[model samples]
Target: MNPFRHGLLAARTAAVMPHRQRQLATLSAEGNAPLSVLFYHRVADSHPNDWTIGCQRFRRQIDYCERYFELIDLAEMQLRMERGESRRPAVCLTFDDGYRDNSDFALPLLIQRRIPCTYFVCTANILNQTPFPHDEAAGQPLAVNSLEQIQAAADAGIEIGCHTKHHVDFSHVHDERTVRDEIIHAKSELENLIDRPVRYFAFPYGLPEHLTQVAVDAVIEAGFDGFCSGYGAYNLPGESPFHIRRFHGDPEMARFKNWLSFDSRKLRKNFSLDFRLPASRIPTLPVPTTMTPAFSVLG
Candidate 1:
């Protein structure tokens, strides 16, 4: 990591993140106010990976989240926030990259549990049946979710969101035509596949530096209701046009809860905090479980 990134992470680690959770809990007891959008990539029973979690653990997380917060769809999340009507901290689950494993492994569990999810797909990669370029670089090529599976997800009531035509790097592209095409074409293609209006988008490599104002303009121009970034602070109620800030979740139960309950960066934009705050109680995280979800909204 570069010096700046390394330093920023160090600062976050030292911020006594657990204090934020206690604050959130106190606020919740008073009345639900905090809101967080959790981001995930893959859910497969595979070798250890930073981006993927096993199926059983994923199910456990869904169960825990359901118990803690009402799992509202992106539309409800925005509406509740825009109207200032949420009673408790809300949590939304999202996945990126449209991995076939998301369909083969994750989709079944979500379908069984009837949990709502927004899957941001790279249209070109799915159409072409290709691995994401990053996967190629790591010498671990993986399958992009196929249109058949994507359609099935939509059929099962999961929301379909855009991630660009080919997962283009918005930060590097200077051509206005490229940006427009990436945002517009991706939305159109996905809509055609799902036969529904694509309402949300997430910038490819959604860091501030990895994206430009031109890119943001294109998403708005293309008529998306909202968009998401790869990392950032949490979203409280009343924030509008719903630009979601997302963090990659950990597979380990304890580590992921630490992030869910107490990550210091939760309040900072893109996880950058200017003032130094002393650290606070780190709660014992819940153990992982293989139990199935208790209820399925779909059923």
Candidate 2:
């Protein structure tokens, strides 16, 4: 364990945590409380990068999450949310940018355990076998999963969703055409590839500022199950479809436990569960007047 991380966590625990961990102890009927959707990018044994987690650590996390709370996929989580089922805490394992190591390492283990996860794929990269710009910039360009492997994973019961065609940023996209091509058309393209209806849509670089009402409108027009934002928050039992949230997973056991147990909602400002149709009611985000968010890397 890194002493620096320990000290920082201790300091934050003193300053940020509440007197009571009501986030954990509080619950709804039947012992359920809320939903946590953990999103990962890659899982492999070698060529480690900022986005990659070793296979062993990934397995241990799955084991731990299973022992503590119910492990579910996006579909089930939505179902539970609609049914008002929050008797026990639930988590969904989701991966962004479908990488080939997912087929080689992650798929077999998930298949064996019969645990379900959703893979958000950038269709253009998979078709072209080029690295995403983010990975390229990070100097860890890795092989992404092929069409056959993606379809095979789908065949083995893994949910496939769109991560946009080029992994384009939506925050600045003001026009409707960009939304149609990147968000709408990409979903159709992936559906054609897998021969199944792709329901979920995850935002590329999913921060609050990276989201725009235009993209949300296009996703609604295309009719998806839900969309995801990556800003260290959990889903209360009855959240709207478009306001789905995501959390980053850590491979280090101690750090992972701390992240999983921490109530990110405490960091949320003006967050609330509004389950209205036409899907508007995403919680109002704090206006980014702070210089802090630029350096913060939650996802």
Q: What RMSD does each model have against the real structure?
A: 9.6, 8.7
Pairs in steric clash, model 2: 31-87, 31-88, 32-86, 32-87, 32-88
Q: Over 4 Å off in model 1, which ranges?
A: 1-22, 29-32, 262-265, 270-299
Over the stretch 123-232, how does candidate 2's per-residue lDDT look in tens digits? 99999999888888988888899999999999998889999998888777767897789989999999999999888889999887776777877878777878887766
Model 1, residue 90: what's the lDDT? Answer: 66
After best superposition, candidate 2 residue 40: deviation in angstroms? 0.2
Best by TM-score: 2
Which prediction has the highest lDDT against the true structure? 2
TM-score of each: 0.80, 0.83
* Clash pairs for candidate 1: 16-279, 32-88
Clashes of 1: 2
